[model samples]
Target chain A: MEKIIVCIKGVPKPGSIKVDPETHTLKRENMELILNPNDRPALEMALRLKNTYNTEVVVISMGPPNVIPLLKYIYALGADQIILLSDRAFAGSDTLATSYVLAKAIEKLSPFSLVLMGLKSIDGETAQVPPETASLLGIPSLTNVKDLFMERGKWIAIREMDYGEEEIEVTPPIVASVSPLAFDYIRPPSLKRLLEVKTKEPLICQVKDLNLDPQRLGLQGSPTQVIEVFEKKIETKGLVLEGSPEELVEKLIEILKDKGLIKF
Target chain B: MFEKIKLEDLSKENILAYGEFYKGELNSSSLEILSPLKEIAQTLNKKLILVSLIGSLENIKDWEEIKKSLADEVWFVINEELKDFREDLYTEVLVKIVKFSQPYGFFFPATKIGMSLAPRVAGALQVGLCAHVNNLEVKDNQIIMARPTYGENIIAKLISKSIPIMATISLGAFGIKYGEKEPSIKEIIFPEDFVWKSKLKIRRFAPSKKKPTKLSTAKVIVAGGRGLKNKETFQKLFELANLLGAEVGATRPVCYEGWVEEERMIGISGVTVRPKVYIGFGISGALQHTVGMENSEFIIAVNTDKEAPLVKIANLALIGDAGKILELLLKNLSK
Candidate 1:
């Protein structure tokens, strides 16, 4: 089957993030996990390709047991298959280690023609795993892909550059990262379809099953470390204005004029 | 526990600085690395080298002054195909160079281009890297880099046990300035037999005619956020911006919603701006957006909700409808 595999992460929702002062580590106690906001675009893009072609879309993730429901939600969203890379050994894997494990799992699911991922995860905010997985798998990769389509058996992706966008083509068994801002936000699948697939279990791939080296699995294998974290002082409040819109604007203009920002 | 190893075997080469450029001219953010890196190079007693990939080869005329005054030695890898950025090409070429240099320290600008490529290279080498660091210090042969996190609510001090420590520094954190002394130069040829035999192809190249809002260099900026609502209302930001002779900037969601151009977005993922005067209309000051603009000299945020994060940061937190306030301000200013 012509298939595309998407790498997804289940990240804790933004705003409730709290760090432990004593350990200098992220405090996940009572935190609600959600599908990473950034990865939705890539999933949406992959689903679009599936609708247009004779292809199967697969959603793959490496997270705790909680990630299974998320993969099922993706399955409900038109994914043909769900694969979860979950194991105690996979805990504390940084971007490099995470990509290594992901590349191995992807290899296990062979005959895949394309790989799609979001630009970065909200929690770690590293944005490294997608490209790193592409490199480890020895495939040509494109980052910041805003627009994509299949033409003449090649994948055409418009990548966002510093000043503008550039269009490029890559042969399959290649990787492309979707920009969160580039495409239209994903629409919800029908309620009936979502409920039907929410209970299906994803195929779980353990550490040993992937044939990865034990020496390169988790925290010990990662090279960089966060020595400490500090609560930074926010800048003090500026000026507070309470009045009608006209009065507020007038006060603003007065302040600007006082600062020589307005002449006359 | 991890420190009980021989440090002598580590790759202790010069500090490697990535040279970011647009067209043929160097980006202003590129110069931010030179001075801080020079200090670290001295502390480590290693040289500071520039690893530049020139998409279009020209005489050192454009970069001569920077080379002479800031860097110890300059290394350029020229590939005419590099006139535009291709991730496969840039990553492949940079991987080869990193293998050659084995840098003790490496710095990248915290822009979209740099953020995208740096992680890929670090992943290729299987090392650790800190992203968007605003401050850095080197003491006793260890690099301590401070990076903001959790919406700028916390600052994380990072250390890389990896031999070649890598980080992408924030733009305004290390302001670009000129230096005086002339430095030396060298060139490394792009690797042969390294193209991987037509792995990827450029089907088409359509450059975005849109330029970065020039918010960083502007003296005055009038930024709008989601509160402005639709594209038609967002256009009012331009009207106010023009009236004040200011540049236009927007929150990330505004750009993501297509109300404003993506290039005009200001946030951790977009542009970092520190204009003399920044006026926000209907902005909620999410950490993502505020991180990119907190350095502004004077901040004026307009919001109907007085408790919004932007209100806390603004020198003038105007409690009102952003659209209404902007309309009145525009009308009164013209009179």
Candidate 2:
């Protein structure tokens, strides 16, 4: 059976992220870890394909071992397999090195008909991994993918352009990133099936097992370096307009008219 | 006395700026980055070079006009296959350009296309890349780029620590500046041996709605946010917007609530607009959202909470109920 790989990440639950007042660094401790919210649609897309076509869905994440629970969360939704690409050596990898490690893992699990991922992770918030991974794997990729369907052995992707949407088709072994626009289409997971999802121990892969160049496996392979992180000092002009609702509207428009924003 | 920078910085080449022109001219977002990138180039005594990709050779004629009017030298990438943005193909072309040029510094607009392509280019070349970068400082020959991260709450300063320093500059972050006359243009034919395993074929496009609001170019914009409790009150914003000939916009939450169409939402997840006048009702001015419209010529915000962050940067902060103010505005304007 063909396999669909969903590259996922563990993100700090919203309202759970706390910043250290002094260092301005994110304090991940004591935060509830959840599946990156945006990745849900990609997971749903994978499940939808499985329901239509007889395919196995594998959800993969790379973080600390604590990330395993987030993968189990995917199993509860219907993923067939899970893998955690974790190791001390893989820590502090930037987007480029992160994509490199992910590409290697995807290559090891070769014969994937499609690789689905979220456009941007909430924490990292960069949509580069999907294409970077495709580049490393020698395949075509698309970003901002909102809709996908199979036709004549090719995947038709509905991508959200800046002004309009465009439909594109390409034979898989392709990588496609899901846009936030796809969130509305995700179906609810069944509670009963979620309970029955026998959680299996996720297979783990280390840097050595992937046979990656030792020099390029972690921080050393990453290019970007953070010099300092500090709180942004916002200088706000304390200007307040005093009036009733109607008076405020009238006065505001009068001022805007002065700025040539309104006429007559 | 100010002495010249450290010896290591002296050997760096000219600054290469990457962007494209739309409808015969560079877009406002591209110009915004070019202006600031140009400033940096001058500070470092380096020439500013703009490299753009054109789908056809004919587009170069349009580019020639842009060169004469502003900027230093312009480089054009004429590739038939590269007309449309295919991530794999664009990455391939960009990677090759970076290799051949070997620019010491680079700038790309942080549009959807740039955000998608910059990281891959940075990955391919093994260089550092900062996203939505707004500030740059060079000290001791080291370039430091700073950008708002963690939902715009914290600022992170990044250094390339490698050969080519790169950043994807956010739109509306800087002002555009013009350079001397006698602009130069150079053309490079795309590499033929470029490799993409398979091609992504464009089948069709969703019918364009030609939204009447046209938020980006709208002279006046009245945007609603989570302060809109009901769809009825949300409609009041539209009524007010129509009366003033303003475009109707909303924050992400308003769109999620189905109060407004997704395309009408303004923020990081939506569109970035710079209208002459912006009236935001109930917006707290989150960095993600403000990054979209902060460049508006003037801003007036109405929110009951005086302590809301949105009130801070607003030119005129009216402490009141958003819905009430919007309704009154519509009532007065309709008169």
Candidate 3:
């Protein structure tokens, strides 16, 4: 049977993120954690493939111990097995460092035919890890994948290219970063399946377990650094126009002219 | 005292061209990218270059004007054989120019083309890239690129240690600024050896029957959200927009609830808008929905929720139901 790995991230719940007053850093304490919204589509895609092609879906994540609940949630969605790659050594890693650890994990879980991931994580929006991970593994990668189908043992996928859709066919061992738009089509887990998998324990692995280069798996491994961050304060209050229909149209034209957005 | 830096001073300066469509016209995001390119070029005293791989540069009417407006020189890799965008061909051209030019940084718009090309370009160059950047600045001799991460909730600043640092700017993040001094445009033709991979084939281009009404580029926008409660109430928002000659927009909830189409949603996931007058009706101003239009010149929010973040950001916060306030505003304006 073909094996597929879907990468998932545990992120702060929507509207629950808080910023520290003094440090301006994200305050994680007391925040509700859930699977990243984008990752849901990847998991859904993997589940669909598993149902159709008789495949095994493995959900993988790298985060703190608190992320196990998220793995359990993925299991509820029909993931056959779960891999939690957690360790203090992997903390504070940027996209580059994080991809390093995940690539090593993928290498450790070799013989897999496909890897699926969200185009980006809600927490990091860098959208770098998927392609970076693919590069590290020396495999062909596709991103912004909207549709996927299988024919004659090869995956036919529709990807959003620069201007429009480009359909490509690739054999297994390919990596894909799915877009968030695809999640709306996914079917939620049935209550029976949820209850059945709710009690299952996830398989946990650490950096040492993957046998990754200790120097290249965390903060010290990250080449890029965030020097400082400050909230942007808007200085311009802006122009307001109010009046009748014709008058408002005239006023809008004048403003656009002044701003050079248009010319008369 | 400010140090005098020469145009040849290649210490730590770079230009990123948000990938534009090869066929129809130059992407509007290119203009937005040029706004910062002008500022960065002046600050860093480095040459600005714009690169595009297209069927024919002759077809682009604004080619000369755009070249003169932004880059000190314009480079085009024209390939009739490469009319449509192929990842391999485009990536090959980008890698060649980046390696030869040796720029300190690169920029691409956070569009479909940009998101695809950026990571591959960075991978080919083996350097760090920051995607979907909202702000870019030169700080302490390093390019500080800020992008909203964590679902547009918190900003992440990334600094590259290697040269040719790449980033893709989110639409509507930076307003367009036209420089007083025009640029001198120079064009470089691509050599014949440009590689083309025909792995993907374009069947045809079926143009949209309804031309995309340029709502995001409108000077005035009147938007409604799920707070409107019903389709009948949502119609009044459009009536007001029509009366004001403004485009109609909706929040994610409005679109999700099927009150409006996805094209009308205004937010991080939707189109980014910077109208002159942005009036929000029955919208709670969620961050995902607000960031797209927060840069509007004048924001007037009407919502029952006094504590909504939209109300806090609005210049005029009317404390009442959207339907009631809109009716009163309409009647008052009719006089």
Candidate 4:
């Protein structure tokens, strides 16, 4: 059967992840991890395609060993196969290095017709991985994809651009990054599927499993290094005006006029 | 055939900026990077070359702006094959050009095309790229890039270990100014053996029927949040914006609520706008939403909660009902 690969990430629940006030660094440990909000649409799209086209939906994640539960949870959501790529060697990989590892994993699962992913992770929010990975795999990437369909066995995707929308027709072995704006509802977990997945485990892969160059696996492979990270504090002219809505509106109008924003 | 420059012989000294010339007009943001890049180039004693790939040479109408950009040189790869952007082919040609030019750094505007194209070129070259860079500094001959991460709550300073420190500059991060200079021009011809076809093809593109949002370029912005309640209440913000001749923006929640198009969402996940004046209605000022508009010259926020985070930083914080305030503001402005 033809296969579609959906790359997902387990991220901290929104507003649950906290930053260290003193060090200005993220405190990622011991936090609740949920499927990345952005990845929901990607998984949903893959599952829909699976239902419609009879394609196999293979979901892959790259994170720590703790990511297994998330993978198991995804399986309950209708993924045929779940794979976890976890290793100390994979730690601290930036977008490029991370995409390299993902591309390698995708290559290992060869003959797959499509690769799908979220345009940006909630934590990182750098919509770079999909394109970078596609480049490494020597395939075309359509990112921020709002809509996609198969026409006569050809892939047609409508992507959201800064200016407008673009419709593209692409060949197979292509990667697409789904936009969060595309799909709002991710199917809830089915009780029967969840119970079935309790006994199912993800196929785990470490550095030794994949034929990866040690020099290109983790921090050592990363080209950009974060020298410092700090909390951004904004200082503005604090002025509070409290009164009736009409009074406040009148004050604002006067201010706009003073600033030459409004003409008489 | 273009002469091949070997990687080993590359000096990696000059600075290069990607000049986005699409259709007939040069992107203003591409020119904006030149102001800061000019200073860096002067300090490093390196030539500042504006590199561009164009579909046709005769269609170029922004040559006057290029001439006054203070760039030391111009490099153009003019070909009919480039008429439509093909990611693979463009990445291949750009990788070849970077290999030949051997620049110490390359800057691209953080735009739709740049965001997509820059990473692919960086991937092909196996170089590090800092995305959405807010600022840059040259320290000890290394380009240090600063960018926001973690939902715009934290700013990270980074340095690239690889040559040709590539970065996509954030929109409106740098302002543009003209300097009189006659830059030498060079045209590049692709190698004879480089004839290649891309697997990706454009079926069609229907430009937005609505007027281009142009939020990034708007001098004034009137934004709304969930505090405005349902769609009907939110619609009043547009009337207020129209009277003020300002663009409309939204917080993530409001956008998710389907009050506005995703493009109008101003926050970490959406567009970052730094307008001359910004007014927010019913916004409680989450960091995710505030980061995108914090750089505005002046801010007026109308929220019921006086202690809201955005209220504390606003130039004028009006504590009142969001819907009521919006209604009143619209009535006053439309008069």
Candidate 5:
């Protein structure tokens, strides 16, 4: 059977993660982790492809050992196999280093026809890893894909552009990053499947298993380094106006006129 | 005929700025980054170079306009096969050009194409790339780039350790400055020996029903949030926007609720807007949404909760029911 690989990530649930007000550093201790919202579309597309072509859908992620449960959850979603690439060496990997490692893992799972990933992870929001991984694998990448399907043994992707949309066609051995909003809804995993996968251990691969260059694994392989992290402080005029809705509307109009926002 | 000429000067390093054409015109975002690049090049005392990959200069109607813009030199690499943007082909061509040009730094606008292409080229070149950086500065001979991360709540400063330091800068982050530079245009065609075919092909394109309103450039924006209650109330925000001749924007929750188009979402995952006047109805102003519009010249927020984050940062905070206020504002504006 043909193979399709979907790259997913576990991100901290929004609002649950906090930043140190003083240092502005991320506070991750005991933070709740959830599947990246953007990655849901990619997984949904993979499942659709699986149903259409009877292909085996493989899910891959690069994160800590604690993310194993997330991988199992994906298994319950109908992924034929799930692999976790976790190691100390993979820690602190930037987008470039992360893409290198993912490319290496994809290489190990060679002969796969398609690789799917989210347009951007909500946490990192770089939107660079999928294309970088494709470059390393010497394959084409279509990003921000709103629509994708197979036609005449060729894959068609309709990518969202700034002003419009462009439909593109490509052969297999390609990478495409999906836009989550395009999908109306994602199917939830069944309770029975979740219960079954909970007892099964995910296949974990460390740095050494991939035969990656030690220099290209983690922070050492990362070319860009975060020197400082700080909160962006925006100063605002603390002026509050309290009145009836009609009175407030008149005051707002007066202010708008004062600011040259309204001629009347 | 293509010439295999190589400039082998290892001592001199120049700043390379990527220029892009959108829909047969020069993308304004691509040119705006040149203003900052000009400063960086001057600070480093290096020549500012503009590089473009094109199928033909004839395809770009504003090629002459771009050629006259501020740059020491403009290099246009042409190939009939390079008509459309194929990530694989573009990355291979760019990596080769960067290898030969040996620039000190490369800058790209964080457009849809740049966001994808910059990282691929950086990966192939084995270099570092900063994504959607809002600011750039030179200190100790290294360029420090800063970008918002973790839901735009935190700004992280980054530095590249490798040369041809690459970064994708946010659009509209810097002003566009046109200076007097009669740049020498260099046209290079790929050699016949370099034969590569793109596996990807452009099938077709479907433009939007109407010309999309870009919230980033709008002078006035009337935005709504979940506080609007339902789709009917959200529709009123558009009516008010129509009366005010302003663009309509929405918070992430509003977009997720399907009250507004996702493109109009103003938040961390959405478009950053810097309008002259931004008025929000029923917006609680989560940091995720505020970061995108906080830079507006003036902000007026209407929410029942005076203590909402959005209300706190707003220039004029109205402590009242949002839907009622919106209706009153609409009536007053129409008159």
Candidate 6:
């Protein structure tokens, strides 16, 4: 049977983000952590592939020990098995370092026919890790994939390229960064699956267990360092106008013109 | 103190190109990189080098002239099969040159072809690579690169810990400028018998032709959000944009709702714009959406919410109905 691996990230839940006024760091206390929104599309895609082709879907994530709750959630999504790569050494990693660790873990999990991931994580928004990860593994990869299917042991994908859409056909051992649009057609998780997931335990892995190169798996291995993080000060104050629609628009146009936004 | 250099100074730095002109003249993205290379070279007082894989030295006369307009030295590698961009061939040729010359820094446009070649080069060299940089500067004998994060909401500064720092600049970040003085150019020839491997096959080569909306370079831009309600109201926003000779943009929600296409969205998931003038109609200025266009020279926000975030950053904040304001703007512009 074909095997597939789906990489997921547990991030701070949306609509619950609170920033510390002083440090500008995200407040973790009382904030719920869940799988990244984009990862749902990846999970759904994996599940569809597994069900259609009688394949095994393995979900993997790297985060703190507190991220276990999210691993359970992935199991609830019909993933056959899950692994969590939790280690303090993996903290404060940028995309490059993160991709390094993930690629190493993928090597350990090799022999799988396909690998899947979300196009980006909402928290980081770098959108570079998946492609970088594929490069490290030396595999053909497609990004921003809106649709995917398998026919006669080959994978067909519709990818969003810089200039237009591209339909590519690649044999197995391919990586794909799926777009959120792919999940719009998925049905909600069934109750039986949720209950089964809650009663199950995920296989956990640590950096030590993976035997990865210490110099390339964490903060110490990272070549790029963040020098500073600060909020940008707003420089322009807004112009407030309260009047009839016709009057307000007339004033707006004049303002735009004076600013050279509109010549006439 | 941060010192700035003029574009003309780039003629002193070494500029190098790899591979032949498969698709005609150097890619536009390459030209964009040359703009900053010229400026950065002047600041560091380095020589420019250009490396080519195919065609005779005379065939690249125009490229040499453009480079001579700014570059100091050019290296040409003549190989019949090296005309097109191939990962294995390009990587092999580039790695050898980069190892031999040991340039202080390297820059590539963040195009698909460039993206494919950059990481491989970095990996082969055993160095770190920074991608999608918006700004690059030299300070205290180190290259400081700035890249947008959090969907352009935040700018992250990074420096290479390893030698020969490499980065790929986002396409729209650097602006092209002409230098005043004609540059001095010299050519170097590479010996034959370059080693190459062919592991990947080119099943097909078709252009996607997906053009990024030149929102970042627009002189003026008109944006809308959830408040625009429906396609009809969004149409009014476009009308105003047309009258102002500006491009039309939308918020994330509006784009997600399919009220407008994704290319028209502005904010973290959308394009980062620094237009001369920006008009926000019925937009709440969510942090994700605001960062993309916040750098505009002037901002005008029209929304019923007086305390909306859009109002806070706008130079002119009009507190009124977005639909009504759009209608009035269209009427006045028509007059």
Candidate 6, B7-114: lDDT as tens digits:
223232244432224444554555556676776777777765544555444444355446434444445555554655555556666777676677777667766556
Residues A92-152 of candidate 5 have per-residue lDDT tens digits of 6888889999999999998898999998888888899998899888888888898788888
lDDT winner between candidates 3 and 4? 4
Of the pair 2 and 6, which is ahead by DockQ? 2
**Candidate 2: tens digits of C-alpha lDDT, residues A106-140:** 99888998999998787767677787787778788
Misplaced by over 4 Å in model 4 are A18-27, A260-264, B1-12, B267-269, B332-335
lDDT of 1 at A170: 77
Give candidate 1 regions above 4 Å deviation.
Answer: A20-23, A27-30, A235-237, B1-12, B59-61, B81-84, B189-198, B227-232, B304-309
RMSD each, Å:
5.0, 5.2, 6.3, 2.9, 2.8, 5.8
**Taking candidate 6, what TM-score does its chain B reach relative to the real chain B?**
0.73
| lDDT agreement of model 4 with the native | 0.83
lDDT of 4 by residue, A80-161 (tens): 9999998888877888899999999999999898999988887877788999999999899888898888887789899977
Model 1, B1-335: lDDT tens digits are 01211223323388888887667767667677776888888788898877677765663346655654477766666667676555667777777777766788778887667877787788777788777776678867798987667554566787888868988877656566555666555556544556633466766666667655577778888999989877887898898787778999998778867887767777665677888899999998877788788889899999988888888888889998998888888888889
What's the CA error at residue B226 for candidate 6, in Å?
Answer: 3.8
Q: Model 5 residue B102 lDDT?
A: 84
TM value for model 5: 0.93
Best by lDDT: 4
In candidate 2 chain B, where is summed lDDT lowest over 10 consecutive residues?
B1-10
What docking grade does candidate 5 earn?
medium
**Of the candidates numbered 5 and 6, which has the greater DockQ value?**
5
lDDT of 1 by residue, A1-264 (tens): 369999998887777787766646555435667898888999998988888887989889998887877888888888889999888777666677888898998888888888999988877777777878887887777888888887888887888777666777777788788988766658687687687885678999888789988777766666666778876445548777889888999998887787667777
Local accuracy of candidate 2 as per-residue lDDT tens digits, B285-321 = 7776776787787888899888777788788899888
Best by DockQ: 5
In candidate 3, stretches whose alpha carbon ends up further than 4 angstroms from where it belongs are A18-30, A160-166, A170-172, A183-185, A231-264, B1-19, B55-62, B152-157, B177-195, B198-210, B230-236, B252-270, B287-289, B323-335
lDDT pick, better of 1 and 2: 1
lDDT per residue (tens digit) for residues B11-79 in model 4 = 356899999876667888898888888888888889888888888878889988988887877778877
lDDT of each: 0.77, 0.75, 0.71, 0.83, 0.82, 0.69
Q: Which lDDT value does model 6 have at B177?
A: 59
lDDT of 6: 0.69
Candidate 3, B1-335: lDDT as tens digits: 11322223322245646437557487777777877766776688776666667776556667545644566655565657557765545776777777666786688877767776677677667677776676778876667877655564455677877677777777766666555556543334455554555434454444445556566788989899767778778878777776677888998767756677656778765678988888788898876777789888878776777677787788766656676666655664456
